[model samples]
Target: MLPHYAAPIWLKGGGHLQTIYPKVLALPSVCYRRELLSDSTQETVVAYDFIDAPQTHAPVVVLFHGLEGSSHSHYALTLMHMVKQKQWHGVVVHYRGCGGVVNQSHKAYHSGDSLECEWMLQQLRQRYPEQKLYVMGVSLGGNMLAKYLGEAQNLALADAAAVISAPLDLPMASVALEKGLSKKLYAPYFLRSLLPKATQERHQGKHPHLHWDHLLASNGLKDFDQHYTAPVHGFDNADSYYRLSSAKPVLRHIQIPTLIINAQNDPFLPPEALPTAAEVSACVTLYQPDHGGHVGFVSGPFPGNLQWLPQTVLTFFSEHA
Candidate 1:
């Protein structure tokens, strides 16, 4: 077994520090080649790639970012840089407007956009037919990809997969985030970006049924999902959306070698909500650390680095491949 992960002593603030460290301090300078790809809905999203010998049959790592996250996210940059160091190709696929491209579709991306996840993987599989393909998803993207794995395991879109800090149980996740620091700090952080685009889309007549006041008045993700996300995505309400979207229900169906790394203390998902070995197929491996909060897995000395998460994920992929 790999060595156990222990948060650096310098990160004394616990989950909060583990969660915010990389996002606030570990951002690095790197270059990427951007490509725009459209889905079945004709909505386009950009993929920022870190490439080395584009035509080589070397392995390819496709990453899916969290809600409102893009290629510029700390996790994306850190992982892609690591991929480059390994001389492997890596690409971060942005979800709709998250890439600053302002998606054309009237509907916004959701927590359970499994179809979109598979569509992107299919495209990547086609582009690199002979190359070994590995997939990694962070937070929201991780949950979506896990759902896709269970629903489309027969397709075998990837040789291996890794999910980081995903909230597999949406209902539980909703309640978790609406309380504590998740509500006070993270909610406003996400709302600043979500409210504006949703507000603009409402003004453009893309969301005619939603109350403008409610969308703008949303204090947390639950309220926003109820007002905008559920209705726009064709779900009856937030409750129904959460019930049908969570990956926990379908984890037993996964057939690919998959690693699910959800910190036991993740603010977004309570310890009780985590799936047990009985809840998953033999192909699924759980790595529930005592720390690492959300997608934050900082390690090293005084000023921690973002290498732990990427190294752990890549090591899993290498083993499976």
Candidate 2:
């Protein structure tokens, strides 16, 4: 059966409203046990916060947050809350330099960097061999998860996976976020968080060759990626980075049961850029609802309910597990 999502009457049409509502609203607090893992580079360590279930042998779900997002992100906390309610173990992977600590290395996390994701999964599987493992990622994290799933086909990283609001087609999604009202709203917000971090990393001599002035002039994602992301990540340019990193082309190679959910009203991706049936493998299920802006899939009336996304994701994982 196809997944059906009905937006509340008061929150049906506007994408912006759907996207912004949850961020402004507050959910219950969740406590986590922090675990820091040293990276392969040896200089830096990434953090993972574990929310253990009450039962001893509960299923484990690994969560990947979006660009510049951490375990404290609204979606991360809300989903972790749901995982606890289901008596399942949940852990949120904090990309390098994102776990409230500046990474020792110059390289930061990006949408296409799946090596870290693969490493984290392998470590989790080794640590908890008795438990069933599942994975879910949001936005940029979703893209990385999809790429990892497709690339690591035969390896049993997790029992099943889900990707939400991912910008699968990076080039198109970049364009969508760069123009019109989206540029006016989203770009500035992202830059506010990203620029300072980039600057701080650079000041610590992470990228001595790149001109700090040039990178500092970048006012948006595209400019920032062109100047900082591509060069530091070993890409020829931003376009090449997008083409190589995009999850769309690799979707057909995925072997495990996976769910890909996107909202038609997502401000970050154009509807035309979404993949067709031919683009994905038989094991992949695509659920595109008419309304759930970006990472926001708010339902219920008035102030709204925060459980829709977590419920949908958990249901998919449960079915496959």
Candidate 3:
């Protein structure tokens, strides 16, 4: 049986689905700042900060977005605004090739690419060794962070981690994303944003595995991964990547006070993909909300709408950290 509060969130008025609210929703605008990090690869990750007071050795929260999402995404900006009261520094890590610059390596970020998050943590830690470092990853970002936390498991670098609306089982998520009216509505948007970047990589003469036209022809998440994600990222195929990268197997290994938040109504996740509190690490807390859509947890009926995810996230981080 589903949890008592587990219910799908549908269009509030029972009409057409709307992506954006009528007003700005009483959230502060996110300020964008760019930083250049050099390794073997020269990458520029954009950071979105909400700085109201001086922060010395203060806890910093890093925000990661879903596929095709960036620092400008509504939820990303909303999260930055929500953390201002805690006086926590909010920084959104823009994935390679999404923040207006191509990455030095031909490899693009995949579902289990925790190295990037680790690198970001190392970068932040180098600057503030005494401060706490927390991460909140949404959707694809969530999957990556979960894998990272599981692998890191009590490492001093990551103080706490939270994942909102992650598809723990990538194979199941791939199957879910290929069905129903929702698939038709969501698939094109992701493909449109994803394929062009792959094409650009091909133009740069770096990624031999990327077939620009083939990626453009992909129908869904699975299709895209099969054609683009796996090949370009060193996987045999989509199935291999999904099987190896799923976070479920690693959940038990996570030692930090991690929180996994998923909404039953989340279209991207199959009902079976949801994890139980018992199945995860003792330190991991699972919050499967009654409704939130896929990271869309708006509340109240007003011109100025309010979101529940950001507030809930801050509460989780504060309580754990």
Candidate 4:
């Protein structure tokens, strides 16, 4: 078993954490207030909202999931429970296809898709204009959230935000996933979740252009992105997507107080993928630890609860809020 100090403040992927917390994951969790918002293309976007009991004017904590994840994901549910316990509301933003309900438009979710975050925050501001809004994104979701903050640094949609295990350097992250034993373990898990949804969309005639053979033949996430995500999204190639979509460039532009956690031992992000303390803006805090096994931070002995990240998040938000 990994020691307690080995567990860092952040982890990159939302994949294996579910396997580690299967028992505690079965606990009765609070349900969120779900809604479907429409974009300019008239697509129905799914969002789950969990309002606090007794309605305190606390910050609305938005949780963004990694590839093919929903609010029901163990981490999302666990964080939602934490938010409720702290007297704050929680909202999980489900990317277009991830909500189990297909969106009306063809634009699916991507690592750099920050438009949805912008739109969701706008909607939240309209309803609860007085309440503070913040977001905590995991893995790819973290990349998206960071990009959004950097892109909209001057905007008032969010007061502050936190990104747990974000891959600021996507190219490095891709390389990490491709190395030796890591490839055998990580690639298949992502493909299993990503491919079927594309296949489903193809069957539904929403994305008839997607080719199953091409998708199946693809070896890694970068390969899949090169063939599918880039072409559909108007990028030159996977490299361009990795460069432009990466959050590193925008990290310096973020005006809001943001915390980014990177684990040195994360299977997804290499040690080099971690941002240097100098790279962070005055408002950004980069927390790096010796280990965390890609979001697996088991604390205590009896329950071995995963409370560190959530509690740190609450404390950070409270201090800056």
Taking the candidates one at a time, how many backbone clashes does each contain?
0, 0, 0, 1
Off by over 4 Å in 4: 1-28, 206-212
**Number of the predicted model whose lDDT against the real structure is largest:** 2
Give the whole-model CA lDDT for all candidates, comma-separated.
0.86, 0.87, 0.73, 0.74
Better of 2 and 3 by lDDT: 2
Q: Per-residue lDDT for 166-234 in model 2, tens only?
A: 999999999998888888888788888888988888777688877678778986788888888898888
What residue runs in model 3 are displaced by over 4 Å at the alpha carbon? 1-27, 39-53, 209-212
Worst 10 residues of 1 by lDDT: 46-55
TM-score of each: 0.96, 0.97, 0.88, 0.89
Which candidate has the highest TM-score of all?
2
For lDDT, candidate 2 versus 4, the one ahead is 2
Residue pairs clashing, model 2: none
Model 3 per-residue lDDT tens digits across residues 1-321? 112332223345311133334224565676655665542244434333334326676788888788878776778777777766567777777677766666656667888888876776777788667877778898999999898888888783677888988989998988887888657868887888787777777777866646667777888877889888898778999999999988888899999888888877677886678998677989888887656567766665444344566777777778766
lDDT of 1 by residue, 213-270 (tens): 8878999999999988899999999999999899989999999999999988888999
TM-score of 4: 0.89
Candidates sorted on TM-score, descending: 2, 1, 4, 3
lDDT of 1: 0.86
